[model samples]
Target chain A: MSDEIVELTASQAAAAVHAGELDPGELFETYRARAAADTLNAYLWVSDRTPAGPPAGEPAATSSPLGGVPLAVKDLFCTEGVPSQAGSRILEGYRPPYSATVVRRLAQAGAPLLGKTNQDEFAMGSSNENSGFGPVRNPWDETRVPGGSSGGSAAAVAAGLAPWAIGTDTGGSVRQPAALCGIVGLKPTYGACSRFGMIAFASSLDQAGPLTRDVTDAALLLRHMVGRDPRDSTSLEFPEPIELPTREDLRGIRLGVPDELVGEGGGVQDGVRRSFEQTLELARGLGATVEPCRLPHAPHALSAYYLIAPAEASANLARFDGVRYGLRVDSGADLVSMYSRTRAAGFGPEVKRRIMLGTYALSSGYYDAYYGTALRVRTKIAEDFRTAFQSFDFVVTPTSPWTAFELGAKLEDPLAMYLNDFCTVPMPLAGIPAISIPSGLSEGLPVGFQLAGPAFSENRLLAAAYALERAIGFDSSPARRRDPGGSTP
Target chain B: MLERAQVDHVARLARLELSDAEAERMAVELSKVLDHIEKIRELDLEGVPPTSHVVDVVNALRADEPTSSLPREVALRSAPEPVAGGFGVPSPGAGGE
Candidate 1:
């Protein structure tokens, strides 16, 4: 019975619960036990209590859209009374007084809290190694990283510790991890999801998304995760409700393969490139038109993103000055010394490096040369995408340059780590939506094929991805590949 | 390339106190990053305007009506050092270099 329960996808579990075939409490316990024993370090904190039914006057769990499926949340989303640390020592043990608007909405829709997952500190770094709590291991290969800063969330879903999880993407944090872990991850258009109560990383680029086993689940989870909130002025109403995609063939669809991202200069690995080409061929077979398109400025996206994101981060993180919350180091000196000491002690090395880089970029003399230029480059990148969309319905690329590398492979080289976002950064800069779907394995590890569209085009992207997914027939179960006995539970 | 002194100056501007070793390491790492970012200077951005925000939202103010706020005790729950009724901090004129 436990084995059968673990095999069900989130959509299946929700359906079973709604039809009175599965008890919501029983469903919660099964996942809770697995999360408590998680050896991947995927979860930072697991809830002990089974969620109560919706509050009085609300619909029962069986009638709700989510139907009581449990969710694993990345630690950045502030859950009232639950430790929401954003995987940094600076905010360790600090629980927000109120939950994020997204968390409250999911609860109202009948999804219960499964646990808080680990991540890279303040959602920085490509691999999970930057997490202050320690890195999460890839379930496929324990020696390899799951990719990050949403590594824990992706790992949780892939390892079946949780049916689905939420992660924030600021330069491919969500999609890259999901691609490495063999699952679906979506980054909605900018302003599609509210940013309130989500610990800010890069204000303009941060957007929360879902990591799940399939495209259908990703679409379902995102349906309830979007909307406008007065607290987040940047958030706007989604033009329409998301519907489950049923398209199984991509007839009349046009895909644009960005030359700058996929060409030889991008450092794409042999296996990943092969898989991407094969997926394009498969799309062509499914009646879609595949053509090469150019985003000329995309080659420089990584440099622009690094400058812009860190510049915003330097300003946003200034609030952690030991006066209001979290960790504090009293230097037994003046307020200035105290502030400096607290921050230096609290933030990890990567966070400190970014803060220094940002400060230098925004400094009096250097501002025009660095931050100002990066912003202008950003406009050109957006223009590139806008021009490409005029000729194609979706932009296609390999989600990552390669499959998951060993945990410590790139830690010594920050440049190498930043390169992991090379193919995934342009869409976010353009404020467009993109989704990463598992195309197939590259050397026995998953390689994701990414499809991105113009702003507010999630419905069409998901439909196209759904069609490609059925045609590819990629197997998503990690347990089957790891152990024949299926003894994880 | 960023010198150690420049790294220290930026650290001070950011209100972070780094040891000599971390500062030295940062100088090298930050220099490499800046070298890569310098590629943007080759582009002709004469007429390009800087994008501060991707979405065009003007004056996103909400209603002036009052709503219940976090209670004093709940708000202070995570403070490292809570004073009689607020957060505690070192005095402005206390000891320092």
Candidate 2:
């Protein structure tokens, strides 16, 4: 019974609850127990509250669209009384007095908080290894990463610890991990979801997205997550209501395969390339026209993103002075030393590296050469997308050049780690929407097929992905192939 | 490439203190990142305007109205040292440079 319960997706579980076939309390307990028993170090904190079964006489579905389904949130979302650490020691044990807008809305819509998942410190690294807490292991093979800074959230969904989870994508944080973990991930158009209580990383780029076992679940979760909030000035009301895609054929869709991302010299592994080519063939068979397109400036997106994101981070992170909330290391002398000591003690190597890099880039003489040039490069990248959208309804690429590598493989080289975002960074730079769905397996690992569309085109993107997902039919069950002894990291 | 002294200077500007070992390593690592970023300077962006924000939103100020705010105690709950209904800090001149 427990095994069967764990196998149901959030949609199926919600339906069962509406029909009185599954008790909400029992459903929450099953996921909570699995989360507490997680060997991947996915969950930083698990909630103990057994949800009060939907008010006395109301049907579960009528009370909330989620039907009391439980959710796993990345630690970056402030959850009122729950510890929202953002996977950093600086904010350790610092529970916010209020919940993030997204978290609050999801809870109001009947999804109970299941746990807070681990991530890279301040959402800075490409792998979960940078987390102040221990790294989150890949459930598919315990030896490799699950991709990050959304590693824990992706691992939780792929391993069935949570029905679904929310993760933030500054660059490829959501999609890269989803690809590696064999699940669906989506980065909504910029400002689609309010950023109210989410701990700031790179303000201009960070957007909260969902990591789910399937495309439909991704759509369902996103419907309730987006809205304008009074607190977040950048947030805008979604142009249209999100709908679960019912489209099964791509009869009129035009998919642009960008040479900059998929062509030779892009460092894409042979196995990944082969899988991507096969998926393109599948798209053609479904009556979709696939043409080679060029996003010329996309090749330089990583260079621009690394500078821009960190520059914003350097300013946003300045709020962590010793005088305010979070950890403080006092020098017992003066205020300046106190601030310096607290930050040095609290931040990890990656965070400090970025802060220093950003400060240098923005400093007097180098600003024009580094920071200013990066922003101009950003303009060209966005222009490339604009030109492509004139001809193609959607642009496609392999989410990452390679599948998940060993745990410590890229840890020593930050450049190699930054390269992981090569394919996914351009969309965020353009402020467009992109979704990564499992295309197939290569070398016994999952490869993601990414579909990106112009700004506010999520409905169209989701529909196209749903059709392709059915045609590709990649199995995600291998994520549960955990060894009995693998439970102890 | 950034020098060790340069890294230390940047760290001070960012309000972070790095150990000698960290500074040495940072000088090399930050240089590698900056080298990759150097490619952008080669592009002719003479007419291209910098995009600080992707979406065009200007002066997005909310209406001036007072609403309930976080109580002082609740706001200070996460502070490392709460003093006199506020966050406590070291005296400004207790220890001089």
Question: Interface RMSD value for candidate 2, one decimal?
Answer: 1.6
Candidate 2: residue pairs that collide: none
What TM-score fits each model?
0.98, 0.97
How well docked is model 1, in DockQ terms? Answer: 0.75
For each candidate in turn, the interface RMSD (Å) is 1.8, 1.6
lDDT of 1 by residue, B30-84 (tens): 8998898899889999999998788777877888999989899988888888899
**With candidate 2 superimposed using the best TM-score fit, by how many Å does residue A425's alpha carbon deviate from the native?**
0.7
The sequence of per-residue lDDT tens digits that candidate 1 reaches over residues A271-355 is 9999999999999999999999999999999999999999999999999998898888985778998899989999999999899
- Model 2 residue runs over 4 Å out of place are A53-62, A481-489, B94-97
TM-score of chain A of 2: 0.97
Error of 2 at A183 (Å): 0.4
